[model samples]
Target: MKKIFFLYLLTLFSLNSYTQNLIWFIENDKFGYAHKTTGRTVITPQFTFAGYFSEGTAVAAVGNHLLSSKYGFINEKGKWLIIPQFNAAGNFSEAKARVQQNGKWGYVNKKGIFIIQPQFALCYDFKEGLAQASVKNNLWGLIDSTGKFIVQPEFYSITDVFAGITCIQKNITDKWEILDIKKKTSIKTNFTRMHAFADSLAPARDTSNKWGFVNTHGNWVIQPIFTNASSFSEGLAAVEKEYGSWGFINKNGEWVIPAQFDRPGYFFKGLALLEKGSDIVYVDKEGSLVFSFKR
Candidate 1:
């Protein structure tokens, strides 16, 4: 039994490693994928639109125009795993993808079968076995994988579930509050605004409009100082120190990459995209330019 468990763990690691090595790239007006390390094109640009791989599949679209494109799933080799049919699609999460049929959104299995029928006016990708769905434009709630409402539609807005916690706004004028979804209880917080949690921390704004990081328990992990801040990703987050200047900071709130770029993005797979002057570039954790691309 121990040997069987070891093999299962190894298999999962291998699959994760393979998916992390690929990044979507754009060529001409088409989208393709390339190796993250070597920047070698693994799949030629063909799709009108493409998204990062998740759960061993990536979302791609094909059609003459963006407005009329039909989205589908593709494998590592760029072959269509699920034929382009849906008017829109999202990345696979928890073995299911949100797809739009007719005009309503629903969740479908990897086999392109609707496990959850298209009824939602809008929906988000599943996170932590739960997803935010809405029957109306402004009303949102949480639903389990079985399409049953664990939390009925009431919040004006709901952030993505992370670490079993989510941030929700009760009304348009209501401040965001942390909720422990599993426990169905609200966590008392001093924050005036909060974004979705990532890497165990959420980018939050205090009553003074200063940004910082907060833990799942609603305690400030990093004190509010920055003018603007983004959620942590792979241990680093992009923060705006002053107007128009952004840099990367560690969890300790230290500027790992000094405030210089006009704009900065969160680190993903050891790299982050930044903009300086009129140039858009991908840089390593050390702030070394990996490559520049046309935006």
Candidate 2:
């Protein structure tokens, strides 16, 4: 089946070491290239700036003029896979790429053919089977890979589809609500700020500015309590309850680890990166330090 477009860069549930295969920079009046992970030089720095590779291809700005930029796709071996033609472009997703020309946005196939017309004011890369597009009113809605409107441009804001539900904000006064595309109705909500329910739970904020967890049915499983909170990852979430410190919490609102770090990022690959003073540390969900790394 053809994949749908995405509203934004969707985070995968499973964590892995995502790497940029190549890097590009301008050096000595030319663009230079190197293997980002290995630090090995591949192409001489000659282009003005280089974008990361996606689907084994990348785009580069060749001249000094920012508006003169054209896009080209390159292979892993630094060969030109598709010559630059697009006035502006984004990485490929779901076998299609978002491109800009004549100050409008559309999609192009791997072969660089325009598959969708440039009509929407903004567009996100495809994911699952839909992409988010913005209408003139600046409201966002979902479209399929063929640019067909599947969800009309009515939502003031939206989150990527998680599990099978997407969080959408209908109006500035309205709180974030869940939308079951299958049901075509807003899922009930009591909290103002909430992440899309995944794994049967989501993070929500009370009017008092405290944070907690809730199930898909809009029931609070973890009462509204923390000062700050993040979306769940690996059954854990980074939260802050006191000034200048952060910690992790489980679905039941249990403090799996004491609030201690200065700042904590969401967990990935069995570890979460944290800060203390000027130092950075990796920690497990239990709050034990895994290792320290240079920031």
Candidate 3:
């Protein structure tokens, strides 16, 4: 039994290693290099525009066309593997990417061959096993990577996919609903406004304008009491009282850190950006200030 448990843990680690690392354009403008482990830039800052690295290559823009920037692939050495062609492009996922031509979106394999023809009005990067696409009617829906419609275009808007479920807001309705892709049924909740779920729960606003959280099971683990609330991150959430200051709350809705910061962004990398008047600081879970940055 101990050997079996150890093997299971190893499998989990291997699976985690397969997940993609987030590469962002992090300089003053759209041009930047891939952020690397030594806290250094992978590709030098020379390209006019860049996208995140995926599957060992990145999409970059060349030439000076402000309105018609063309996209091509570059390896770690900044060598162009694929020449600039698509007017717009997204990063590779599942060995393929979505490219735009003549204002329509379609899919292309790593070799730049179109596996799916350009048709949709809008297309998104693949996550989990599906991607979101939009049609002329303005309703968005989910499609498999092969361009097959898994969920028909029925929602007015579509957010990120998490835990095999997608958060969608229907047209002419202010309420947001979670659609189970496999079950094809909406999770029942009483939230008047809802952002996407994070850390297994979503921040929901009640009719009274109070904010709280609800799990994917449509159960309220935290009651609607705070005047404002941000999404949960790293086991803690930020909340604000009516006409009051902002603070951090644990999963149980207890104030782990009291209301003190005049304004706070959601927690990231074990810290949150706090603002007071014109000053900005990074605070830990205990509300103690850690780092400060000038605006």
Candidate 4:
């Protein structure tokens, strides 16, 4: 169930927020950080792979994603705080980062001490004081920073915890159910896909394979209609119409940026990445192409 590993590994490096004015990016197959506002290089691209800094530290690897063995923690200054030894590493969250040792996963503190022993079949970075872990590759559950099970291992898989609410699915069941971290409510649902919550709403796919947004209470704020959709960021969500054209939509379901781009990304810090034919362009919330990357 190192699904958490797969989920993170498959993502292409993008401009992800690190600190208030810093961001992470990849150039020439190497990962580094840069100033978000001025677009100036702060940390040069050196690591084979890099993740956004959390609590001032990031996870970096030195080789291919699958066969790589050199993984460690790096500080904002691009210095190794923890030497590369683990098989895999998760970005620091809540001052702890999940790491793999001898094929089992555990969490280490800022000092690289194993606060939790390497025992879980899979482990994820803590979010909202809890993390998803699996035991023996079967019992999925929620564990606190102390490595105690807050939610017993019984579900098939656990989704990201957001706003004290996380949706889970039962063993072998296709339907999803909600788990209220605060209320300890029983999970239940019919969503074909339950995306991570963003901007006070989460994207859910109906049985008909259409996408829409639902509030924390599970009420549909926007009807399921888009051919393809993404979670919101900065009050805007990227969606596609019938002909594969992409645009940005406000929470009210109104098109803020009319469908025009061939493909689009979420707005991060007032700008989104758009695809114009084979090239990449950065566009503002107003849908104007501000910067185009030369190939």
**How does candidate 4 score on lDDT?**
0.76
- TM-score versus the correct structure, for each prediction: 0.88, 0.67, 0.68, 0.81
Residue 286 in candidate 4, Cα distance off native in Å = 4.2
Instruction: Itemize residue pairs with steric clashes in candidate 3.
Output: none
Candidate with more favorable, higher TM-score: 1 or 4 = 1
| lDDT per residue (tens digit) for residues 123-207 in model 1 | 8888789999999857999999989988889989888888788998888777788998878899766677787898899999888
Best first by lDDT, ranked: 1, 4, 3, 2
Question: lDDT of all the models against the reference?
Answer: 0.81, 0.67, 0.69, 0.76
Name the runs in model 1 displaced over 4 angstroms: 1-18, 261-264, 274-279
Stretches of candidate 2 off by over 4 Å are: 1-52, 65-68, 195-202, 220-295
Candidate 2 lDDT tens digits, 190-220: 5677764555677788888788887766778
- Residue-level lDDT of model 4, residues 20-49, one tens digit each, is 655555566566777766778898988776
Ranking of candidates on TM-score, top first = 1, 4, 3, 2
TM value for model 3: 0.68
**Alpha-carbon deviation at 174 in model 4, angstroms:** 3.1
Q: After superposition, how far is residue 191 of candidate 4 from its true place, in Å?
A: 2.0
